[model samples]
Target: MTEISKISLRNLQKRFGEKVVLNGVDLDIAPGDSMVVIGSSGTGKSVMLKCILGLLRPDGGTIQLDGNDIGTLRQRERNALLRHVGMLFQGGALFDSLPVWENVSFGLLGAGGISRRDAKDHAIETLAKVELDAPTADLYPAELSGGMQKRVGLARAIAASPDIIFFDEPTTGLDPITADVINNLILERVQELGATTLTITHDMASVGKIASRVAMLHDGKIIWSGNASDIDRSDNPYLNQFIHGEAIGPMRPDVSTTMPKETY
Candidate 1:
Protein backbone atom coordinates (compact mmCIF):
# COMPACT_ATOMS: atom_id res chain seq x y z
CA MET A 1 0.00 0.00 0.00
CA THR A 2 1.20 3.48 -0.87
CA GLU A 3 1.45 6.09 1.87
CA ILE A 4 -0.29 9.41 1.44
CA SER A 5 1.68 12.63 1.77
CA LYS A 6 0.56 14.70 4.75
CA ILE A 7 2.36 17.87 3.72
CA SER A 8 3.28 19.05 0.23
CA LEU A 9 4.95 22.19 -1.09
CA ARG A 10 5.04 22.94 -4.79
CA ASN A 11 7.03 25.69 -6.54
CA LEU A 12 7.25 27.67 -3.31
CA GLN A 13 8.87 31.06 -3.67
CA LYS A 14 9.71 33.79 -1.17
CA ARG A 15 11.89 36.90 -1.16
CA PHE A 16 12.99 39.61 1.23
CA GLY A 17 13.60 42.84 -0.69
CA GLU A 18 16.43 41.95 -3.08
CA LYS A 19 17.31 38.69 -1.37
CA VAL A 20 15.55 35.72 -2.87
CA VAL A 21 14.87 32.69 -0.67
CA LEU A 22 12.96 29.52 -1.39
CA ASN A 23 13.23 29.68 -5.14
CA GLY A 24 10.57 27.36 -6.47
CA VAL A 25 11.17 24.75 -3.80
CA ASP A 26 9.12 21.58 -3.77
CA LEU A 27 8.82 18.91 -1.10
CA ASP A 28 6.51 16.08 0.04
CA ILE A 29 6.33 14.46 3.46
CA ALA A 30 4.26 11.38 4.13
CA PRO A 31 2.44 10.85 7.41
CA GLY A 32 4.66 9.63 10.28
CA ASP A 33 7.85 10.33 8.30
CA SER A 34 10.72 12.03 10.06
CA MET A 35 12.24 14.43 7.53
CA VAL A 36 15.39 16.31 8.47
CA VAL A 37 16.37 19.22 6.27
CA ILE A 38 20.12 19.87 6.43
CA GLY A 39 21.80 23.07 5.32
CA SER A 40 24.52 25.53 6.21
CA SER A 41 23.54 28.66 8.19
CA GLY A 42 21.76 31.42 6.21
CA THR A 43 20.13 29.06 3.75
CA GLY A 44 16.34 29.25 3.45
CA LYS A 45 15.65 26.23 5.68
CA SER A 46 14.07 28.20 8.51
CA VAL A 47 12.27 30.47 6.07
CA MET A 48 10.76 27.44 4.40
CA LEU A 49 9.57 26.15 7.75
CA LYS A 50 8.13 29.53 8.72
CA CYS A 51 6.19 29.55 5.49
CA ILE A 52 4.75 26.16 6.27
CA LEU A 53 3.75 27.33 9.75
CA GLY A 54 2.19 30.50 8.32
CA LEU A 55 4.56 32.66 10.32
CA LEU A 56 5.77 34.17 7.06
CA ARG A 57 3.96 34.65 3.78
CA PRO A 58 5.44 33.39 0.54
CA ASP A 59 5.35 35.39 -2.63
CA GLY A 60 4.18 32.42 -4.67
CA GLY A 61 3.49 28.67 -4.81
CA THR A 62 1.33 26.34 -2.80
CA ILE A 63 1.61 24.75 0.62
CA GLN A 64 -0.86 21.98 1.24
CA LEU A 65 -1.69 20.04 4.38
CA ASP A 66 -3.79 16.97 3.76
CA GLY A 67 -4.54 18.36 0.29
CA ASN A 68 -5.85 21.68 1.67
CA ASP A 69 -4.01 24.77 0.46
CA ILE A 70 -2.99 26.48 3.68
CA GLY A 71 -1.25 29.34 1.87
CA THR A 72 -4.61 30.78 0.96
CA LEU A 73 -6.10 30.51 4.42
CA ARG A 74 -7.18 33.59 6.34
CA GLN A 75 -5.51 34.35 9.69
CA ARG A 76 -8.20 32.61 11.71
CA GLU A 77 -8.28 29.61 9.40
CA ARG A 78 -4.49 29.41 9.36
CA ASN A 79 -4.43 29.53 13.14
CA ALA A 80 -6.95 26.71 13.24
CA LEU A 81 -4.69 24.68 11.01
CA LEU A 82 -1.67 25.53 13.15
CA ARG A 83 -3.40 24.07 16.20
CA HIS A 84 -2.41 20.66 14.88
CA VAL A 85 1.28 21.54 14.88
CA GLY A 86 3.78 21.40 17.73
CA MET A 87 7.03 23.33 17.51
CA LEU A 88 10.29 22.89 19.42
CA PHE A 89 12.35 25.94 18.66
CA GLN A 90 16.17 26.13 18.42
CA GLY A 91 16.55 27.91 21.75
CA GLY A 92 13.69 26.04 23.43
CA ALA A 93 11.81 29.42 23.61
CA LEU A 94 10.34 28.77 27.02
CA PHE A 95 8.99 31.66 29.03
CA ASP A 96 11.40 32.52 31.83
CA SER A 97 8.63 33.78 34.10
CA LEU A 98 6.54 30.62 33.81
CA PRO A 99 7.13 27.49 35.86
CA VAL A 100 7.88 24.23 34.08
CA TRP A 101 4.37 22.84 34.36
CA GLU A 102 2.85 26.06 33.11
CA ASN A 103 5.29 26.03 30.19
CA VAL A 104 4.43 22.47 29.32
CA SER A 105 0.71 23.16 29.53
CA PHE A 106 0.89 26.47 27.68
CA GLY A 107 -0.80 25.23 24.54
CA LEU A 108 -3.30 23.11 26.37
CA LEU A 109 -4.47 26.04 28.47
CA GLY A 110 -4.40 28.55 25.67
CA ALA A 111 -5.97 26.48 22.90
CA GLY A 112 -7.43 23.30 24.31
CA GLY A 113 -9.45 24.92 27.15
CA ILE A 114 -8.02 22.34 29.50
CA SER A 115 -8.59 23.19 33.15
CA ARG A 116 -5.57 24.03 35.30
CA ARG A 117 -5.66 20.75 37.22
CA ASP A 118 -6.14 18.68 34.07
CA ALA A 119 -3.43 20.65 32.27
CA LYS A 120 -1.02 20.00 35.12
CA ASP A 121 -1.76 16.30 34.96
CA HIS A 122 -1.17 16.28 31.22
CA ALA A 123 2.01 18.25 31.73
CA ILE A 124 3.28 15.74 34.24
CA GLU A 125 2.57 12.90 31.85
CA THR A 126 4.30 14.63 28.95
CA LEU A 127 7.22 15.57 31.14
CA ALA A 128 7.63 11.94 32.17
CA LYS A 129 7.85 10.98 28.51
CA VAL A 130 10.75 13.42 28.13
CA GLU A 131 12.41 11.92 31.23
CA LEU A 132 11.53 14.83 33.45
CA ASP A 133 10.06 14.11 36.86
CA ALA A 134 7.14 15.95 38.51
CA PRO A 135 9.35 17.58 41.14
CA THR A 136 10.87 19.85 38.54
CA ALA A 137 7.51 21.19 37.45
CA ASP A 138 7.51 24.10 39.90
CA LEU A 139 10.91 25.40 38.87
CA TYR A 140 11.34 28.36 36.56
CA PRO A 141 13.07 28.07 33.17
CA ALA A 142 16.23 29.72 34.54
CA GLU A 143 16.50 27.08 37.23
CA LEU A 144 17.07 24.25 34.78
CA SER A 145 20.14 23.11 32.90
CA GLY A 146 20.19 23.28 29.09
CA GLY A 147 19.26 19.62 28.76
CA MET A 148 16.49 19.87 31.32
CA GLN A 149 15.18 23.00 29.67
CA LYS A 150 15.09 21.23 26.34
CA ARG A 151 13.18 18.39 27.93
CA VAL A 152 10.64 20.90 29.20
CA GLY A 153 10.38 22.36 25.72
CA LEU A 154 9.80 18.88 24.37
CA ALA A 155 7.12 18.32 26.95
CA ARG A 156 5.43 21.56 25.97
CA ALA A 157 5.51 20.72 22.29
CA ILE A 158 3.97 17.30 22.78
CA ALA A 159 1.50 18.34 25.49
CA ALA A 160 -1.48 18.43 23.17
CA SER A 161 -0.37 15.41 21.15
CA PRO A 162 -0.24 17.43 17.95
CA ASP A 163 -0.40 15.53 14.66
CA ILE A 164 2.63 17.35 13.19
CA ILE A 165 5.80 18.54 14.93
CA PHE A 166 8.48 20.97 13.87
CA PHE A 167 11.94 20.84 15.43
CA ASP A 168 14.31 23.69 14.66
CA GLU A 169 17.93 22.84 15.46
CA PRO A 170 16.72 20.74 18.39
CA THR A 171 20.18 19.44 19.25
CA THR A 172 22.29 22.43 18.32
CA GLY A 173 23.63 23.68 21.67
CA LEU A 174 23.69 20.55 23.79
CA ASP A 175 26.70 18.29 24.47
CA PRO A 176 27.01 15.09 22.46
CA ILE A 177 25.53 12.79 25.07
CA THR A 178 22.71 15.18 25.91
CA ALA A 179 22.01 15.75 22.24
CA ASP A 180 21.85 12.02 21.70
CA VAL A 181 19.44 11.65 24.57
CA ILE A 182 17.19 14.39 23.21
CA ASN A 183 17.27 12.78 19.76
CA ASN A 184 16.29 9.43 21.25
CA LEU A 185 13.50 11.03 23.26
CA ILE A 186 12.21 12.73 20.13
CA LEU A 187 12.29 9.47 18.19
CA GLU A 188 10.57 7.55 20.96
CA ARG A 189 7.83 10.11 21.54
CA VAL A 190 7.20 10.69 17.85
CA GLN A 191 6.95 6.97 17.29
CA GLU A 192 4.58 6.59 20.21
CA LEU A 193 2.33 9.27 18.71
CA GLY A 194 2.83 8.27 15.07
CA ALA A 195 3.19 11.92 14.05
CA THR A 196 4.78 13.53 11.02
CA THR A 197 7.82 15.68 11.76
CA LEU A 198 10.10 18.14 10.00
CA THR A 199 13.41 18.94 11.64
CA ILE A 200 16.06 21.44 10.51
CA THR A 201 19.57 20.89 11.75
CA HIS A 202 23.22 20.84 10.72
CA ASP A 203 24.12 17.94 13.04
CA MET A 204 24.99 14.93 10.94
CA ALA A 205 24.84 12.65 13.98
CA SER A 206 21.28 13.86 14.54
CA VAL A 207 20.53 13.17 10.90
CA GLY A 208 21.70 9.58 11.35
CA LYS A 209 19.66 8.99 14.48
CA ILE A 210 16.40 10.81 13.75
CA ALA A 211 15.76 11.04 10.03
CA SER A 212 13.98 8.46 7.88
CA ARG A 213 14.50 10.83 4.95
CA VAL A 214 16.99 13.66 4.40
CA ALA A 215 16.73 16.73 2.26
CA MET A 216 19.57 19.19 1.69
CA LEU A 217 18.72 22.86 1.13
CA HIS A 218 21.08 25.01 -0.92
CA ASP A 219 20.78 28.13 -3.06
CA GLY A 220 17.18 28.62 -1.99
CA LYS A 221 16.09 25.18 -3.14
CA ILE A 222 16.12 21.52 -2.21
CA ILE A 223 19.27 20.32 -3.91
CA TRP A 224 18.86 16.72 -2.91
CA SER A 225 16.45 14.50 -0.99
CA GLY A 226 16.49 10.75 -0.42
CA ASN A 227 16.46 7.98 2.13
CA ALA A 228 18.76 8.82 5.07
CA SER A 229 20.89 5.74 4.49
CA ASP A 230 21.72 6.86 0.96
CA ILE A 231 23.17 10.25 2.00
CA ASP A 232 26.72 8.89 2.25
CA ARG A 233 26.57 7.60 -1.30
CA SER A 234 25.01 10.74 -2.81
CA ASP A 235 27.12 12.07 -5.70
CA ASN A 236 25.75 15.61 -5.64
CA PRO A 237 28.69 18.02 -5.29
CA TYR A 238 26.80 20.25 -2.86
CA LEU A 239 25.97 17.28 -0.68
CA ASN A 240 29.59 16.08 -0.83
CA GLN A 241 30.92 19.50 0.11
CA PHE A 242 28.45 19.95 2.95
CA ILE A 243 28.77 16.47 4.47
CA HIS A 244 32.60 16.62 4.38
CA GLY A 245 32.70 20.29 5.57
CA GLU A 246 35.16 20.98 2.78
CA ALA A 247 36.28 24.48 1.86
CA ILE A 248 37.63 23.41 -1.50
CA GLY A 249 34.81 21.92 -3.56
CA PRO A 250 32.23 22.95 -6.13
CA MET A 251 30.74 25.30 -3.52
CA ARG A 252 31.72 28.95 -3.67
CA PRO A 253 34.91 29.93 -1.84
CA ASP A 254 34.47 31.69 1.49
CA VAL A 255 34.65 35.50 1.28
CA SER A 256 36.49 35.60 4.62
CA THR A 257 39.45 33.84 3.01
CA THR A 258 40.37 37.01 1.04
CA MET A 259 42.58 39.54 2.85
CA PRO A 260 43.97 42.96 1.91
CA LYS A 261 47.61 42.90 0.76
CA GLU A 262 49.98 44.88 3.01
CA THR A 263 52.70 47.14 1.53
CA TYR A 264 56.22 46.94 3.01
Candidate 2:
Protein backbone atom coordinates (compact mmCIF):
# COMPACT_ATOMS: atom_id res chain seq x y z
CA MET A 1 0.00 0.00 0.00
CA THR A 2 1.18 3.55 -0.71
CA GLU A 3 1.91 5.79 2.23
CA ILE A 4 0.09 9.08 2.71
CA SER A 5 2.23 12.22 2.44
CA LYS A 6 2.78 14.38 5.48
CA ILE A 7 3.82 17.40 3.37
CA SER A 8 2.97 18.06 -0.27
CA LEU A 9 3.74 20.82 -2.79
CA ARG A 10 2.09 20.84 -6.21
CA ASN A 11 2.75 23.02 -9.23
CA LEU A 12 4.52 25.53 -6.99
CA GLN A 13 5.39 28.74 -8.79
CA LYS A 14 7.30 31.81 -7.64
CA ARG A 15 8.97 34.75 -9.39
CA PHE A 16 10.80 37.98 -8.65
CA GLY A 17 9.75 40.51 -11.29
CA GLU A 18 10.75 38.95 -14.63
CA LYS A 19 13.02 36.28 -13.17
CA VAL A 20 11.28 32.99 -12.34
CA VAL A 21 12.82 31.09 -9.46
CA LEU A 22 10.48 28.17 -8.78
CA ASN A 23 8.37 27.21 -11.78
CA GLY A 24 5.75 24.52 -11.36
CA VAL A 25 7.63 22.59 -8.69
CA ASP A 26 6.03 19.49 -7.15
CA LEU A 27 7.04 17.16 -4.33
CA ASP A 28 5.62 14.92 -1.59
CA ILE A 29 7.19 14.02 1.74
CA ALA A 30 5.92 11.01 3.66
CA PRO A 31 5.61 11.00 7.44
CA GLY A 32 8.89 10.33 9.27
CA ASP A 33 10.77 10.32 5.99
CA SER A 34 14.03 12.26 5.57
CA MET A 35 13.88 13.87 2.12
CA VAL A 36 16.81 15.95 0.89
CA VAL A 37 16.55 18.30 -2.06
CA ILE A 38 19.85 18.68 -3.95
CA GLY A 39 20.92 21.12 -6.65
CA SER A 40 23.57 23.68 -7.48
CA SER A 41 23.59 27.17 -5.95
CA GLY A 42 21.03 29.69 -7.32
CA THR A 43 18.77 26.87 -8.51
CA GLY A 44 15.78 27.97 -6.37
CA LYS A 45 16.30 25.25 -3.76
CA SER A 46 16.27 27.85 -0.99
CA VAL A 47 13.33 29.70 -2.51
CA MET A 48 11.33 26.49 -2.73
CA LEU A 49 12.06 25.81 0.94
CA LYS A 50 10.97 29.33 1.90
CA CYS A 51 7.69 28.83 0.01
CA ILE A 52 6.95 25.63 1.92
CA LEU A 53 7.83 27.25 5.26
CA GLY A 54 5.54 30.22 4.47
CA LEU A 55 8.50 32.58 4.81
CA LEU A 56 7.68 33.71 1.29
CA ARG A 57 4.19 33.63 -0.20
CA PRO A 58 4.17 31.75 -3.47
CA ASP A 59 2.84 33.28 -6.66
CA GLY A 60 1.04 30.00 -7.37
CA GLY A 61 0.71 26.41 -6.10
CA THR A 62 -0.53 24.53 -3.09
CA ILE A 63 1.44 23.67 0.05
CA GLN A 64 -0.32 21.06 2.16
CA LEU A 65 0.53 19.78 5.58
CA ASP A 66 -1.49 16.81 6.84
CA GLY A 67 -3.76 17.29 3.81
CA ASN A 68 -4.77 20.92 4.51
CA ASP A 69 -3.66 23.73 2.21
CA ILE A 70 -1.49 26.05 4.27
CA GLY A 71 -2.17 29.02 2.00
CA THR A 72 -5.77 29.14 3.14
CA LEU A 73 -4.93 29.12 6.87
CA ARG A 74 -5.80 32.31 8.73
CA GLN A 75 -3.13 34.14 10.73
CA ARG A 76 -4.16 32.31 13.93
CA GLU A 77 -4.27 28.99 12.10
CA ARG A 78 -0.94 29.64 10.46
CA ASN A 79 0.63 30.39 13.82
CA ALA A 80 -0.72 27.09 15.11
CA LEU A 81 0.72 25.31 12.09
CA LEU A 82 4.13 26.90 12.70
CA ARG A 83 4.16 25.52 16.23
CA HIS A 84 4.69 22.01 14.84
CA VAL A 85 7.66 23.01 12.67
CA GLY A 86 11.35 23.58 13.49
CA MET A 87 14.14 25.05 11.40
CA LEU A 88 17.95 24.99 11.56
CA PHE A 89 19.16 27.71 9.28
CA GLN A 90 22.43 27.90 7.39
CA GLY A 91 25.26 29.55 9.36
CA GLY A 92 23.64 28.38 12.63
CA ALA A 93 21.56 31.55 12.95
CA LEU A 94 21.77 31.73 16.74
CA PHE A 95 21.00 34.94 18.57
CA ASP A 96 24.37 36.18 19.83
CA SER A 97 22.72 38.17 22.62
CA LEU A 98 21.15 35.05 24.17
CA PRO A 99 23.04 32.52 26.23
CA VAL A 100 23.40 29.03 24.79
CA TRP A 101 20.69 27.55 27.02
CA GLU A 102 18.34 30.41 26.22
CA ASN A 103 18.94 29.90 22.53
CA VAL A 104 18.21 26.21 22.77
CA SER A 105 14.95 26.75 24.65
CA PHE A 106 13.81 29.85 22.79
CA GLY A 107 10.73 28.19 21.35
CA LEU A 108 9.70 26.50 24.59
CA LEU A 109 10.24 29.66 26.62
CA GLY A 110 8.12 31.69 24.22
CA ALA A 111 5.19 29.25 24.51
CA GLY A 112 4.96 30.22 28.30
CA GLY A 113 3.69 27.20 30.27
CA ILE A 114 7.14 26.26 31.52
CA SER A 115 9.18 28.36 33.97
CA ARG A 116 12.58 29.71 32.93
CA ARG A 117 14.36 27.27 35.26
CA ASP A 118 12.52 24.34 33.75
CA ALA A 119 13.26 25.62 30.27
CA LYS A 120 16.96 25.75 31.05
CA ASP A 121 16.89 22.18 32.31
CA HIS A 122 15.02 21.05 29.22
CA ALA A 123 17.55 22.86 27.05
CA ILE A 124 20.45 21.13 28.75
CA GLU A 125 18.82 17.75 28.20
CA THR A 126 18.26 18.56 24.54
CA LEU A 127 21.87 19.70 24.25
CA ALA A 128 23.07 16.38 25.62
CA LYS A 129 21.10 14.56 22.94
CA VAL A 130 23.13 16.46 20.36
CA GLU A 131 26.37 15.44 22.12
CA LEU A 132 26.92 18.90 23.57
CA ASP A 133 28.46 19.30 27.00
CA ALA A 134 26.67 20.98 29.91
CA PRO A 135 29.40 23.62 30.30
CA THR A 136 29.00 24.56 26.67
CA ALA A 137 25.43 25.61 27.41
CA ASP A 138 26.71 28.54 29.46
CA LEU A 139 28.90 29.89 26.69
CA TYR A 140 27.65 32.31 24.03
CA PRO A 141 27.49 31.38 20.36
CA ALA A 142 30.54 33.56 19.64
CA GLU A 143 32.60 31.72 22.26
CA LEU A 144 31.97 28.29 20.76
CA SER A 145 33.68 26.69 17.77
CA GLY A 146 31.90 26.34 14.44
CA GLY A 147 30.99 22.69 15.10
CA MET A 148 29.66 23.51 18.56
CA GLN A 149 27.45 26.26 17.13
CA LYS A 150 25.92 23.76 14.74
CA ARG A 151 25.26 21.39 17.64
CA VAL A 152 23.51 24.17 19.56
CA GLY A 153 21.38 24.91 16.50
CA LEU A 154 20.48 21.23 16.26
CA ALA A 155 19.52 21.21 19.92
CA ARG A 156 17.24 24.19 19.33
CA ALA A 157 15.66 22.55 16.31
CA ILE A 158 14.78 19.41 18.27
CA ALA A 159 14.05 21.09 21.61
CA ALA A 160 10.27 20.98 21.19
CA SER A 161 10.32 17.63 19.40
CA PRO A 162 8.69 19.16 16.36
CA ASP A 163 6.68 16.99 13.94
CA ILE A 164 8.41 18.53 10.91
CA ILE A 165 12.00 19.81 10.80
CA PHE A 166 13.76 21.77 8.08
CA PHE A 167 17.55 21.87 7.77
CA ASP A 168 19.10 24.55 5.56
CA GLU A 169 22.63 23.57 4.54
CA PRO A 170 23.27 21.99 7.94
CA THR A 171 26.97 21.55 7.12
CA THR A 172 27.66 24.56 4.94
CA GLY A 173 31.10 25.63 6.23
CA LEU A 174 32.35 22.76 8.38
CA ASP A 175 35.36 20.63 7.58
CA PRO A 176 34.72 17.07 6.37
CA ILE A 177 35.18 15.43 9.76
CA THR A 178 32.99 17.94 11.53
CA ALA A 179 30.39 17.80 8.79
CA ASP A 180 30.22 14.03 9.12
CA VAL A 181 29.72 14.35 12.87
CA ILE A 182 26.84 16.80 12.30
CA ASN A 183 25.29 14.43 9.78
CA ASN A 184 25.39 11.55 12.28
CA LEU A 185 23.79 13.70 14.97
CA ILE A 186 21.04 14.75 12.58
CA LEU A 187 20.26 11.12 11.74
CA GLU A 188 20.20 10.13 15.41
CA ARG A 189 18.01 13.03 16.53
CA VAL A 190 15.53 12.73 13.67
CA GLN A 191 15.22 8.97 14.21
CA GLU A 192 14.69 9.42 17.93
CA LEU A 193 11.94 11.97 17.32
CA GLY A 194 10.43 10.08 14.34
CA ALA A 195 10.04 13.50 12.70
CA THR A 196 9.58 14.17 9.03
CA THR A 197 12.51 16.25 7.69
CA LEU A 198 13.25 18.31 4.59
CA THR A 199 16.83 19.41 3.91
CA ILE A 200 18.36 21.41 1.05
CA THR A 201 22.07 20.99 0.39
CA HIS A 202 24.65 20.33 -2.30
CA ASP A 203 26.85 18.37 0.10
CA MET A 204 26.68 14.85 -1.30
CA ALA A 205 28.29 13.37 1.82
CA SER A 206 25.48 14.83 3.91
CA VAL A 207 22.94 13.59 1.39
CA GLY A 208 24.35 10.02 1.65
CA LYS A 209 24.36 10.14 5.43
CA ILE A 210 20.92 11.59 6.25
CA ALA A 211 18.64 11.18 3.26
CA SER A 212 16.27 8.23 2.80
CA ARG A 213 15.04 9.76 -0.45
CA VAL A 214 16.73 12.28 -2.73
CA ALA A 215 15.26 14.75 -5.18
CA MET A 216 17.02 16.95 -7.70
CA LEU A 217 15.65 20.47 -8.30
CA HIS A 218 16.61 21.96 -11.65
CA ASP A 219 15.16 24.73 -13.79
CA GLY A 220 12.81 25.48 -10.87
CA LYS A 221 11.31 21.99 -10.87
CA ILE A 222 12.17 18.51 -9.62
CA ILE A 223 13.66 16.74 -12.58
CA TRP A 224 14.46 13.47 -10.84
CA SER A 225 14.16 11.64 -7.53
CA GLY A 226 14.55 8.15 -6.09
CA ASN A 227 15.87 6.12 -3.15
CA ALA A 228 19.16 7.38 -1.68
CA SER A 229 21.01 4.23 -2.69
CA ASP A 230 20.14 4.81 -6.35
CA ILE A 231 21.81 8.24 -6.42
CA ASP A 232 25.23 6.89 -7.33
CA ARG A 233 23.87 4.67 -10.07
CA SER A 234 21.33 7.05 -11.58
CA ASP A 235 22.00 7.61 -15.27
CA ASN A 236 20.43 11.07 -15.50
CA PRO A 237 23.00 13.56 -16.83
CA TYR A 238 22.10 16.26 -14.35
CA LEU A 239 22.34 13.86 -11.42
CA ASN A 240 25.71 12.51 -12.58
CA GLN A 241 27.09 16.01 -13.16
CA PHE A 242 26.03 17.24 -9.74
CA ILE A 243 27.09 14.18 -7.72
CA HIS A 244 30.43 13.91 -9.48
CA GLY A 245 31.17 17.66 -9.33
CA GLU A 246 31.89 17.82 -13.02
CA ALA A 247 32.47 21.18 -14.73
CA ILE A 248 31.65 19.82 -18.17
CA GLY A 249 28.00 18.87 -18.10
CA PRO A 250 24.55 19.89 -19.25
CA MET A 251 24.45 22.47 -16.45
CA ARG A 252 26.05 25.73 -17.64
CA PRO A 253 26.45 27.99 -14.64
CA ASP A 254 26.17 31.70 -15.46
CA VAL A 255 29.71 32.91 -14.97
CA SER A 256 29.61 35.67 -17.53
CA THR A 257 28.78 38.29 -14.96
CA THR A 258 30.49 36.78 -11.92
CA MET A 259 33.82 35.67 -13.40
CA PRO A 260 36.74 38.07 -12.89
CA LYS A 261 38.38 39.67 -15.92
CA GLU A 262 41.92 38.42 -16.72
CA THR A 263 44.82 40.70 -15.72
CA TYR A 264 48.47 40.58 -16.72
Residue pairs that clash (backbone atoms under 3 angstroms), model 2: none
Expressed as tens digits, the lDDT of each residue in 85-162 for candidate 1 is 899988999999899999999877888667899988888888999998999988999999999989999888888888
Model 2: per-residue Cα lDDT over 43-74, one tens digit each: 88888888888888999999998777999999
The lDDT per prediction is 0.88, 0.91
Where is model 1 more than 4 Å wrong at Cα? 1-3, 253-264
Residue 140 in candidate 1, Cα distance off native in Å: 1.0
Number of colliding residue pairs in each model: 0, 0
